[model samples]
Target: MNELQNTLRRLLRVVIGGRWGVFAWSLSGASALAVILWGLKAVAIPLLMIKTASWGIWGLGVIRESKLRTPIRP
Candidate 1:
């Protein structure tokens, strides 16, 4: 019982902490879909642009971190 309680507590904490990122990603996808489906090309384009820019920034960060983690070949 004690072990089960500890496991549940950790799971709850992880879920709570990750909720915001999950929500934001879901909202971004949903909004983009809404714009596209509703024939709001003008609005959709800008929203997609923003999404792409964010992905680019995220990719850059990942790349930088990966490089830092790797040993230099020189």
Candidate 2:
């Protein structure tokens, strides 16, 4: 089991360190996520809406905090 684990780790290091490996891995993950989201039609819609709203609220909070921290000039 330990030898198998070490071999897997070595393979991963080689794959990730090789040129184009990062892009390939990123693309693979994104494609998998896209397929999963497509399959979850009902859940994805509401989840996306909530995620977008949260981002907007977070942005507004950041803007308000920055304004409050800055001193008003004459």
Candidate 3:
């Protein structure tokens, strides 16, 4: 029972983390601007550009995490 509870907690944390990562990368200020611009038809922004920005955000987060002295654990 304890092991199952631990596994469930880990799974929940991972799911929540993934959602936050997606939101942070894809729904960030720059990404949001790109989306708005695309919506307004002012610029023909490529989907790749948005995806690249999201990857860049993820990369930055990874670098920042590596710089931390202690890794965060749930």
TM-scores vs. true structure, each candidate? 0.39, 0.41, 0.37
Query: Which residue pairs of candidate 3 clash?
Result: none
Q: Write the per-residue lDDT of candidate 1 for residues 1-74, one digit (tens) a residue.
A: 99789767655544333444344456567667878777676576777776776555445545554444444687
- Tens digits of per-residue lDDT for model 2, 1-74: 99789767655545353333444445445545765877666457655655565445445545554444454789
How do all the candidates rank in terms of TM-score, highest first? Answer: 2, 1, 3
Best by lDDT: 1
Q: Which sequence of candidate numbers ranks them by lDDT, best first? A: 1, 3, 2
Candidate 1's TM-score: 0.39
Two-way TM-score contest, 1 vs 3, winner: 1
lDDT of each: 0.58, 0.54, 0.56
Identify the leading candidate in terms of TM-score: 2
Q: Count the clashes in each prediction.
A: 0, 0, 0
